[model samples]
Target chain A: MNPILHELKAKQWIWNASNSQGKGHSKRLTTGYEALDSVLSGGFPSAGMIHINSYLGCGELRLILSILRQMPQHEVAQANNKLRVFIAPPFQLNAEFLLDEKIALEHLLVIKPATQEEALWSAEQCAKSGVCEAVFLWQNQLKHTQIRKLELAALHGQCHCFWFDNNRQCMSNLPLTLSLLLSRENEQMQIKVNKQKVGWAKPAINIKLPFKSRTQLRFKEARKAVNNIVQLRATP
Target chain B: MQFDTCSLWIYLHFTQLHLNVIENTQVHDERELAQPRAIYNMQSNQLVQLNESALQKGIKHGMGLASASLLYPQLNVHEYNEEIEKHALEHMANALYLLSSDIVLMPPNGLVLRAQNMLKLYGGLGPYWQNISRCLSQLGYRYQSAAGFSIQACKVMAKCKQGIISQERDVIEQQLFKCSLAHCDIDLKDFEKLKRIGISTVDELSRVPLSQLANRISRYSVGIIAELRGQAPSKVTFFAPSISYEDYIELLYDISLVDKLVPVLKHALKKLETFLYVRNTQCLHIDVSFYQREHEPLQIGFDSAMAIYRHQDWLEIASLKLEQVRFASPVYALKLVCEKYEVAHASVDDFFTHKSTHIETMSLTSRLASKLGQQKITRLNFIDDFRPEKSTLALADIKSKSLNHAQSVFADRPGFLLETPTLLQQKIQLIKGPERMICGWWDDGVVTRDYYIGQSQQGQQMWVFKTPEKDWYLHGYFI
Candidate 1:
């Protein structure tokens, strides 16, 4: 059996503390972008939390979405019946945009926790249940102990936990397997690895965001209207 | 030749004879400590039945209270309430009815059942017997059980404490032969004459000729012997069980603490499981009411989206609901009511097998709802309205609806929609054309706006809208 598949079935981390020494030997999740994958020496770490610190409105969620798009939907569906959970997102989750990005809407769960405590709890529960492939938690000012608790839950469930914390101070002293500092420089989203448990790192990978044209936007609207009209007419 | 009555019968002799009615409702720890306690019948002015301690102290049943009090100066005397005792027996019967429908209420303190059907129904005699015993034990009853080919044989063997009787007739006969004349429930005058004639065991009595035995003993003795040997059918009125599941416990002492109520509720839940099992149904809802003195009854309820029959699952959810309940007054009585039942569906494993996420999410939702109240947890669903606020509905409202994929028609919308539009602060680059949404005049909330996809200076994509005059509002963010 494939090692990753076997580990997932057993609900244990594929790379434990003892065997996570060799950076080259560690199993990685491909970012789907060849350039970023080559720079990170394969891809992001498959298990444990990956902390991303970025300025507000700096395409932080977009960067993560790019990596998620790389993984096949069937693999995730088969791994465990876990959905993609986004907890206490900064903005209201627009279902339409996610569909445009090719994300399965049924497999995406959004939870809006009213308090920071609840957000941490929701994240931990989602991670510990092993019913979610990825838990994108947007919580600000989590203590060291809270982050450690989340790390342990992620390790035990063998689920990928990503923390999008805006508070830079609280992000430090965390057990994040991979920590990246995201910034916008020269019209490109730059991702610099500040911490790597795998013992090796590369220079910042400047990812260029795709720009949409005016005609393409109008074409999308006209096409949607046509489809809706056709559906409306098709129904009795 | 022996009578070939090929049916298994069970006799349940509730051993703690005196306290049946009172103990079922209220736990009497003090009485338990005062072991040599005698229940005095007020009308008779006599000790009806004394516990083993009182018996050891030379107190006897039907003896005058004065004599019993003289024997043990500290003897605890309690007024015997026949109604309470009868009610308790009925409750026990109802709980046991789940095991077998053909139950006969042996008045005062016993129950008889046709166990042959239950044996096959439960797959075999062993599981069937264990199921009844476990349920009885869980219901907080003290009883001795014996089974045999005939109900008479089971009753006699059980009264003699002959232990569990196998379904085989020979084993029952062997057990009956072991019991002396003194243990058999027969008239005292007839028993003495039979004892004098060397008829000690039931086997000896069975060998005596009917005419000869009738001449020495009463016809009742002969009838008893005939029934034990399965020669005559005992005229028994099998108890019909109540349709609904309900059980009550009266606290010996009024309890102010909520935790103290858990054990009683747990016992009631165990009975509910039996109630469901016998009916071949599952409970979807249960209501618990606490009877307090001089106060309105405090009621709590547990409801499952899916039908559940397991005792532990009910207890688990009840405990969660109980944690949220604050007792205003000391609870005196507790009752568990489950009037309605749904047909039991397939096993739980099938419902959760491939839908682990759905199961976990459900559990999460239940936990959050329990802790944060039911109104707190919600989800989003889209409507046909163009207005952003009116376009979504709370998921909890339409619980039965399945989550569907977002239609491609709404493809040009942003990832997040603000509840209300806020004034745009930063200059943004226009990446796409203004998609004009100009409907909604029919409704009270009318809107006409030009919406565009814009990228902020920090590379964040946003959905912005401009109205008739020239005011720009940030509708939502892409992420």
Candidate 2:
């Protein structure tokens, strides 16, 4: 076996997060496609992290749209969903697909910025809105600096960041907590976690489709045990 | 209405007048007549032929260069000299539109008018040949207008001007017996055959009776028979404008404390937004300039509203803009103005028709503002304009915060906030280091944020939305 493949196998065991303890956090946002979710720890979205890579053929977008398309809704008087999404200037959508999703068309909105400076400003503002759970940039391009600021915003607002692929140039050693590269195999999405903070990287994990909203997973990095159980056996 | 170039001062001086209109006048413009290419060689004088091949290839005289090439092969088209066509079509249409309100300008060299009404206006249009001659004199073009109640007669009147110039259909009735074959957009071939046999002209064609022609050449021939008799056709329908908007404001303010008067201003905004929603429109240029105030009153461009509407998704956007208020010392009066309006289909039954939860919420804000100071009111509007500070806004009198109740916490509301961290009261071990944040470059405030979902020694949970550009402010709490 190749040494790197063996190392990755060993890394996968440890990175497969087993513990679910702490406050509100999800393991990964199901990319809808089954093959893609396997690479993520579980079906959860991390608030402070960035999904930096994207794929072509609209397969990646189709995955997200399919999952979001199934999100439950009612009249405003009944209740509100805990999440919302924001896209920046010149960002466009297929009106036909959206209509097909049974996604409430009124919930969808567009923002046209007069300039790029305005686009960034709008992105940061949306992330802070509190109501919007995630902020996505249909970046014709992206810079490391922009990613870093967005990372901080995701942390500040406890918001998630999904970087859909564009004309973005690839780079290395980003400050992002988790960076995954999404590629296509047989028109199915594949997620490869290049980095992680809590555990080791795993084999490419494929998540399930029409991804149901599951935020029940949150795990803190392993901490030193506070209570040491002193084993005292009764002297018999 | 009467217009005359009859006054001396109104007569544009020769120096200031357009010289090209007078210069382009040719004594006998050959282009006006239908002549074959060989006719130029038979001319008594040497003639400069313009676009002889283009004409033969089917490029009409008045067609534009961009499209002329599509009709004619081997056509060398030139860019339009606006100065030339300006004299032709517009001068022609203006002369025609003066005849009636329902004039339609046909391409190149034709003018159509709904002259039925004009006959009465000009005392039966019989003596109007003088007016036609006078209008042509004012315009440099030498033109001939054929008047008739129907299109067939008008076309026949125009064609018969050269060899025989007689208005009487009875005299034309005699001459029609001598003419040869004819052709037009209509295949008047059968009618030409009938006319060549014994039915000499249109009068002779009409003499055949409607039912006989209907059977002879289809119902269209019957239509031409009616048209030849100078009868008016049925009116064509026109469409109504696709957009509709109506707005008005009522002011009942008697005293000033301009800041205190935010309600009246906000009501106008609510009314404006509702009106736009009904019409399905968006606003870019919005303004409300104060007409009267205490200490030299002020004006505000509706940019504040536009900013709020732009970033309506976020709640703080309009709030920040409204914070720029400079209330008058004795602020005595207020006015609300909607400067820009557009048509957008706002699903009205949801927000506008009656009070839905949104309206109930907006109304609640209005009530709250009425009870509380207007400055304290704001509305949580959802907008996709990416800027956070620009998303949510305080409608001067509109209330703030969503109408939604706080989520119960026996179980965690998956994404609700935890308590925000304040400055350290005591040292604590690190569960996580600060996650830094820096945003906002376009609007000038570069935020560098550091966030933590840290637990204190007591295990109380907190959610914080903070800015490194400013001190951390506690935003949410967990049960």
Candidate 3:
């Protein structure tokens, strides 16, 4: 092979087209949901910034909670007793739910900055501080440079950052390891992969939730009663 | 007198302490020390201390102010302040406390240090005196020092300008014998009586018997002679350094902007660093008070996540805190006070862990707290309570012990709770049945509610509650 072609291959400018598992796909964490994990190649990337855009409470935190529960179980994370920082959550975090899920309360930190700039800054600092295992940031809006800086910070600290945007605005073109948009469809939660580093963008996938809509349950109960009446009339 | 033969005492007599302290406390200028300056005693109406230039201009001590002014027309006179001079001596003693532990303050400008123990630590008298001299030079004071077997003997030699710095008994006694009676700490009438009796030097005074001296001169003079000869023990009180740190720096010119205070604050923090570093202790909080021209002093307090003693760390936090302060008036002085301290312990890191980073968790939290308010960063701890609002507690300090046994009655709860319940505006499909709760009946108010997990039209999961009156309100979010 020519030296120029070899250099291109070394720099990863050219690679095999059929290679399904790339560099980023090798190091991923399972999302605890089998269907969602399959759609996310293996799971979410082990490190770097992840952007999740959704409505205020469309199972976004639940998706992150699954990964957060497994973080401390990792060998490296367990050794350091790293912290999980939450910067500017929408409301007061329920301690009962987190404790029930077996999250270590001692390793949890919540920083409610007064301004948006302070929130972004606190998020970046927590991500860049290597003492943290993960940093979850909830903000209304973020600029392109801020996202890039946050990505670099997460990469440097080797900590995973999950940024939740609930403004219902169109997603801006920003560098990220993975970008997800979440919604609810009846009894299932829909997750669409908008951007992924190593794989092609996937279509929307629905995962069944443990919660059932009361209206749907009521409709089914009414239909069963009517069927019982019809069955009785036919028997007569 | 029963003198400890194994112990040695060193006395430092600050000759021009009043003038030196005035020069040192004022802002330094190139021409300030070059000009003729003298400290004039208002009560005596005479010159008490003269700087080098004033002495060179023939301005002698005890000369009347009119004659001193006639001798040097350009003489800059500062009124003698006994209180400031005493304070200056104490300040010097505090600075030298690190070198020597036992210090006795001889007020209005003198210090007596027990040097026998320190000599052994420093290995020799030469090195010990060198260290003391270096410290005095940094303090920028003119002083004469001497060593002797007794405190009074060293005081007499140092006051007479003998400048003898030795640990050996023979050398100190020889120097003490040569001290002139006129320059000693004796009354004018006693000096005259001693001079009339042909006792101009300490050597001649020691030759007279104590019984004869007691009958001839006053008892004070006889006692002075006995103490100088190591025949009588001198009453001495040792000075103890203050444990708390408080340093005040008055600016020569008022600074209107807070940024200009950095250099002054840095100097004060350097002093605090030495204070803490020597004791191997660290402080958690420091209060900085700025004295303005016309307003009440503004005091800002800040703290670290962990106890820290480094000057750079405090400087960084102070600068961040200063950024938030809006100066109401021009500040003329600044005071840094730290009353609490803890023993410093070396933090051991995991050797097997591979991640190496410059920032630590405590420092990061401190930096954020200094810039943002301290209340912004907190830890969530569960508290055993029936009400959702009282179920969790936010703690300011992460290291504080939290209630670990707090268990909520409700098995299923939302991840986020609204501060207060709001009227449910949108139509919702309830998924779970009402989990009824009757709480706070014995307290401020009664609360009877039925909670249900609901999904809104926009697909947002909400925790809603219904009152007995059939009114529904959104209470929390499942996210």
Candidate 4:
């Protein structure tokens, strides 16, 4: 048997507690980016922490949009798996935008935690609840020492964490599987995947974004007509 | 084998009369039911006794107050108060149940324990008895018990008497022995007479032959003799009798406290429904009593099945039942007892349809009902009279209806039919159509209306209608 599966099942039996009470190791958080996923060893679902500093200038939406684009619908589907994605306190996964992107909203649950502890508690609950796949967390920035407990919690829960630290710095105790230092290089953002177990061709990779052209005016016009019809029927 | 039937009329059996308890209860203190229990009785310690306890030494049960006073100078006796002692009894019962489940009470006092199965579990009667004694000592009940394979032997062991009864081997002999029998509680009166006849052993009694005892012992005694011989059967008194639904709420000033019992009532009603279904029974009478603050209990009898049957139905009925109950005090505990029951068979198809239809209908109706209220929830039943509103009408589940299949005309019904007709209200500027529809004359009410399908500037469609009186009314809209 897999060690994690065995440990979980063993814990279940020895607890002697009825299943009515929920397990205490669940995690429910928002994942930040999609493309940086390849840099993650076991895709962030390991025993460590990684600091994400988005160098998207114009700038934040630039990298955010690119990262969102790189996220494969299949991976998103698998990671979500009947769990509704909850954003930060009082924020929800943008329902309309997610639907437009073909994201399944059925399993996307949005919860608002009043405190940081509550947010962590929700994550622990999700992990121990034996439900959901990857958990993503987007916050202003966590202190370097606080990341240690978070990494441990994620490891214990056996789920991935994509933590966004807006304030850029090289502090202490980075349990991140992927030590990324995102910077603007050669007019395009460069994502340096710095850590052990770097796969394939290179330890670093760079890519140009806005991979779509400003073509198809007729298509735009067709969309406008359809929207007009929707608006016309709004009053009835 | 000591029974001489010619000498006795009544018979009974007593089991588990341990020596330790006999000594403790009789020789020592009798205030065992209250306070920090006075556990053991010291030998030759003469303590003043309660008058009732003193009377029990040699006096009969119901002697007058004057006779009792004459019998004992300062008889400090108190009547057996069941209420105060109930908690103590319950505690003892719980402890005893942990040790043995089949501990049947001989009532007001005494207990009968079956030792056959336990003998193997505990590795023999001796070890079992020792464990029980240890447990009793721990509980401070300080009681004694005795066990034997046969009823007479068991009784004799408890009472410390050497009473006996003959055993029967063949079915013919068993039948001949137990034929003229009357059943009753275990009364040990016959065994007393047998000892009086100078016949004390069961071995001697068996040799005397069944025909001889037939003329001597009463049929009751004969029954007891057969039971001892493993011929007469013992029916357990543990089965509580089944009755119709009855419940009483007393001193219910706190509705929140009574709210806790709602789920319990649901489970009980489910069991009752299951029971009724199994035995093919139907109940028509339901009664509940509610007692107010230290006042007499007020009762209401619901004699119609249509009044309430299911749990949901009962909620409303209970509210109605409570409406008549005037509260005098905050209610502590309520009791519900149903006394009458009758058999009624349910067909297999009806039984199956009842469940599946409930599931199917509830799925659709609950969603609709959640949007609406209880009064608005409905299921499609055929109209008994073909008329508008009467035909395919909506009625509260509070009112039961039977489906009529004959005039059912909706051969092609739409799935998303409106719960109720939606009245159209739109900016009716773009299009207009008041096309006429005259309906409901031939079993479908006499109706005349000019219906209109209109499209607004916003591209929305509306279904409007105009009566023959030129009264324009918006009916509905096609989104």
Candidate 5:
């Protein structure tokens, strides 16, 4: 090997194609959706940073809720039990929905920071604290350095952090465990793998969501109700 | 002398308490103590205490301030403050409380500890006094101490600068007898009368009969002599340490910036650490007050999610909080007060697991809350109500009511709720619902609506509701 190649290998900067096939299987956290799991090789990485780029109300949070609901509660005796922190969430998390999903309300913490800096600080702190199981941060934009810091913190704490960014159109070429782009089309959630640590980015996959829109039937029903009342008024 | 039966008491007399307090709190260098300084008594227009350099410059205690200033024109003089001295004495007693249990605080710089009880526990009086003197030396206060059978004898011996450290009654009595009558805490008129009678030393006073001495001096002076001789019991009140923690530091210079308050605040927090450690207790909340020069004192409060007693942790949290404060004026003093304390509980970590960082959840929450306001960090709670908005409680409004374990009658509810319902401008196709909720008739916030889970063309799921007046509003998001 050349000197430059040796140095790059030493720094772990060069990705070896052979190394991917060999012992590169990191622990995977099941994403609850079988099809989505199959498309991502297994599931989400157990620990480190994952960036999800999608618009709000596009089942982005629902995708995370499925993973959170299945995550094992942290049973460390000294630590708080399975704390899940949400930083800079745009809207209030509905306790009813959380309870219905069986996520413990007591272990849930939500931080609504006033500025982007504070939100980033809170996310890093929660991820590095080693007491939280997962940290979900919703921000408009984050610098590359901020994401790198959050990634290092997550690795140190053995926590999974989902960075939800809705503003960025294309993902930056940051070295993250996973970067996913989600969109809704044809009554299905389209998940595109933009980057992954261990494998090549896969093409987009569509997973039909559970919610079905029966718009025509409801519209006809409403119109019939209105028309029947009008016919009764005319006869009287 | 009944030395074995009677209790031995040690009296510590701080001769230059006010000056020592000022030096200990402010002087960062040992060379600062060599400066020519004196504490002037404003009432008497005389110097009450002098440092070695001031004494070398021909300044003496009780010398008129004008003469002292004339002798050393560049002398630094501070007016004697009785309140600061009293507080310093109490602070010393609080520090000494761990070594000795029975302490009597004599205000304006004096502490008398019952050494006899602690002697047996420490194996001997020598070791007990060694422990006490070590604590006192660490405090950096200049004091003279003497041990005797009675409090009055100890005070008189200490005031005379005997510096006796013996439990032997005969040795203490000999030192007490050599003390002059002027230092016996007697009245000025009694001292004058004693001078006329040629009883200048306590030995001569003790030689005279009590009945004769009673006629020459006041009854109080007679009682003092009797107490000094162990003939009458000395009524002493033992000092009880306060449960709550409070420590104040007067800065040498005015601190205009928040960063400059860190060192002084760290010192005060170290005191609190010891205060809590000695009692094996921790505090959840502490109030820090900054005494300003020209404005109302600024007060900032810090609270921990869990009871904590470590100074480093408190300092870290305090500095974070201090960054947010805008100082109105320069602060001259800082005080930390903690009214509530909880018993310190030992937290056990897993021995098998190898982790790089181990932070408690409560500590993390506290760290966040310290930086961000407390209202910013909150836990989610479910409320027992029929209305969708009322069913989920707002952030930080934690109520202790048992969560209604019963499953929701409606199955499809949105994951997130908006603060207020907005007009449903975008057309949304109904997915499910027509869940009618006609509750809250008694309360001011009534809800009579039909809720439906709807999806827009962008594949966005929204919770829209129609009120009785046929107005549609979006209330929540499925995501």
Candidate 6:
């Protein structure tokens, strides 16, 4: 076998194959997808600030929601007292959509900080308080010091902090535990792990919906159909 | 009138009664020694009450102060103030008023309450007892309790330090009979006479006929026997629930900083909590006024979006409001006035339980409203109209507002609509179309548009409309 292949197999075996009490994989919160979990060596890093850069309308929010949908049943059971905070989202987060996605609304808290400064402050407070298991912050711009403070806060509170921004230049500058870039191509989402806390880097993870061809729900008709579905599904 | 055997009367006996109050009065006092201490009543010149230490030391109540001092030379002695003791008991009764309205003041150091009616409200007697004990403990009272079907029975049982709860009249009578004559609150002269006659227990004294008992003691002895047998219909002044709550704390030292006022505020809040619990209400509006030597009282008032009953929640909001206050002068006192109150809903979650989404949202929005002004937190409200411009967002109110259920005559609206429709200048490919909507014909406003979901040359999905004049306008964008 090639030396690189042998090293990769050994690393994979240690983190993914082993379930014993050896010096195996460090605890990571699974992304609720087995394939993604295997590639990411269990899943996303549990502590420190993770920066995810995604193009507009690239299903970043959907990815975060899917991860949150797994929390109450999995990650939250370990630290049962923590809250999941969503701060300063770009648009109004429909609580109905969240509930339909199986995210526990009682454990979820949405805070709309009026300014970027307030958003940073609220994010740090939630992270540093140890009362929040995960803090999701959506801000397009931030200083290095702010990111450092947020990372320290996440470490202090033992929280999984996610910063969703589209600034690729700043993303490279920050010392994040895990950094990913999400983009859409040919009706599929490509999540590329640009940085990691440990192990060798892997190829981008591609996710394609199997039902899109059957519905022909793409583009303009898709938007209308989505709106109609949301209206029909959520009433009072 | 029929005797209600279902009534469960609760009696609270303060064991370290006066000492507990004195300790709380001395702010930040934490000396909790196990030394034997007695409170001497100046008028009676007797040791009126003592701690468990004194009881273990064989010191008894009503012992001469001189004899007690001579017996235990190193014993800690405290002067019992009648006024202070009455004030403390009234405060405790006011707190107990939350459990039931039938609170009877036993004066000096005890409270008699009718609790059977609210047993189910707190789940059961065990939980109710736990809640009452917790409340008293929070108020810094060292207390014991007893329960019975009658006021006199519970009081006598509490005085005898039996601490038994009995619903059956037979069991209560049996327990009352078992109490020693010295511990029973009978006439002292009659007590002495009964002892001389070898009647050491209540059963022995009850063996004497009413006429024989009256010969040796006052005729009140006959009433006592009737009460003990659950046969007397005694008059009790039922506690009236207060409509509002106001409590104050005089700081031991002048508080120059706002944070120092927290301890005093906490003490007053406990009183407010008890006050609200007894009334079964929540504070809707509260005012905290700070007083100084000569400065005009600075009052900070806030109204909650919903009735707030939790002490911690109330204190949290109060502290948030307090952060904005700068004391004009050195503060010596703080007064909490809850002028407006609303009967809280029965389904309110316990303090330790997770609050329902509605409450959590309301509290969060209310907090944000206070911090960022009410106008800042807005909610999208659907308006019944064909024009997309007419659909407005309003300031979110405290009450949960359901989305408008009025079915729109049109189909396929974009989530993000432009404030004003701009004339489309680019070539567009229509995917779905011709959903013609004609409305606003009345009141001098008329609109006729052929709406369609179109894709621009740049692949931007748009909600575009064509007017009767053949002019096209871009209305919204689909993400």
- Give the per-residue lDDT digits (tens) of candidate 4, residues B1-479: 23222111111122212222223222334454321111111232222122234535443334444554566545433333233233333434445555654555544234555545566787765676667567667545433343434444344333433222222224223322332211223335665656576545554455565667766667877766665554545543431222444332222123334454454445445544644554456665555554434656545454433212355554444543343344565544445445666766443565533343333222322322222234422323334442223443333452254533342132111111233344555465524343345667785457677665554443333445667776665433331
- Docking verdict class for candidate 2: incorrect
Q: Write the per-residue lDDT of candidate 2 for residues B1-479, one digit (tens) a residue.
A: 11121110000011101122322321125453233221111222221123444457665544444445466444432222333333345444444445445554443344444544444667654544456456556655434445443444454554444223234555544543332224222356666656655765544564566666655565665655554554425222211212322222223334354444455555445545544553456664455555454466565543322222322311122233445565555444334445555554445474433324343333222322222234432222323322233322223323222332212111121121212234444333333335454656666765555654433343323334346455554422221
The TM-score of predicted model 2 comes to 0.30
Query: TM-score order of candidates, best first?
Result: 5, 3, 1, 6, 4, 2
Residue pairs in clash, model 6: B97-B278, B98-B277, B98-B278
Error of 1 at A106 (Å): 3.7
Chain A only: TM-score per candidate: 0.75, 0.60, 0.75, 0.53, 0.76, 0.69
Local distance difference test values of all predictions, in order: 0.72, 0.42, 0.81, 0.42, 0.81, 0.68
| TM-score-better candidate, 4 vs 6 | 6
Kept native contacts, as fractions per model, are: 0.39, 0.00, 0.69, 0.00, 0.64, 0.01
Q: Lowest-lDDT window of 10 residues in candidate 3 chain B?
A: B350-359
Question: Worst 10-residue stretch by lDDT in candidate 6 chain A?
Answer: A209-218
Ranked by TM-score, the better of candidates 2 and 4 is 4
Task: Specify the highest-lDDT model's number.
Answer: 5
Worst 10 residues of 2 chain B by lDDT: B7-16
Instruction: Give the alpha carbon lDDT tens digit for every residue of B1-479 in model 5.
Output: 22332788899999899889888777667787689989999999989988889989888889998898789898988888898888888888999998999898898888999998898899999899899999999998899999888888889889889859986778777888889878777788889989998999989988888998887789898888888788877886788888777877778789899887898888889889988898899988999999999999998898876678999999989999898998888999988999999997665656544332334666787889889988888776677687777877655632223434545423456788998999899988997778788889999998889998888887788899999999999999888
Query: What is the TM-score of each predicted model, taking all chains together?
Result: 0.71, 0.30, 0.78, 0.34, 0.84, 0.51
Residues B204-298 of candidate 6: C-alpha lDDT, one tens digit per residue: 86786666766677767667656665667656677564556666655556887878887678777777886777668897778888998669989
| lDDT ranking from best candidate downward | 5, 3, 1, 6, 2, 4
Higher-lDDT candidate among 4 and 5?
Answer: 5
